[model samples]
Target: MARVVVEVMLKPEILDPQGQAIGRKLPQMGFEGVAAVRQGKRFEIELAGPADEAAVERVRELAGTLLANPVIEDFEVHVAE
Candidate 1:
């Protein structure tokens, strides 16, 4: 099976409240030296056959349009080795 991996993350300029919360809580939980945190989504799409150029391109298009929001998030789609 072929695997297409999609990684989605918030834009750098956007504030990440959840990440900040984690960052804050870690220090209180005795986890020091933690500076910052950012959270993201990873999607693994399995196909019946090997990933080709066209298939990767299609997945990239799908990720941009349906998976990640253009206004607040960015995404990358690639074939998993």
Candidate 2:
């Protein structure tokens, strides 16, 4: 079996409310010197074959079409190894 790691995140131009909330609250909790914050998603997918280029491409397609919003979010897929 093979594994792929997928990372999904909002585009830089997009506003992340959840991440903004965290940033705003951190200082109240005694966390200081904050620069910025962003929230993202990560997925570990396992396939029943080798982690070849085709397999990685397939995962990238899936990420673009299903795992991430192409309009406002970007995704990356890579072999675990």
- Candidate topping TM-score: 2
User: Candidate 2: how large is its RMSD?
Assistant: 0.8
Best by lDDT: 2
lDDT by residue (30-81, candidate 1, tens digit) is: 9999889999999999988889998888888888899999899999888888
lDDT of 1 at 37: 97
**Which pairs clash in the backbone of model 2?**
none
* Candidate 1, superposed: residue stretches over 4 Å from native: none
TM-score of 2: 0.94
Error of 1 at 63 (Å): 0.4
Our tally of clashes for model 2 stands at 0
Each model's lDDT comes to 0.92, 0.94
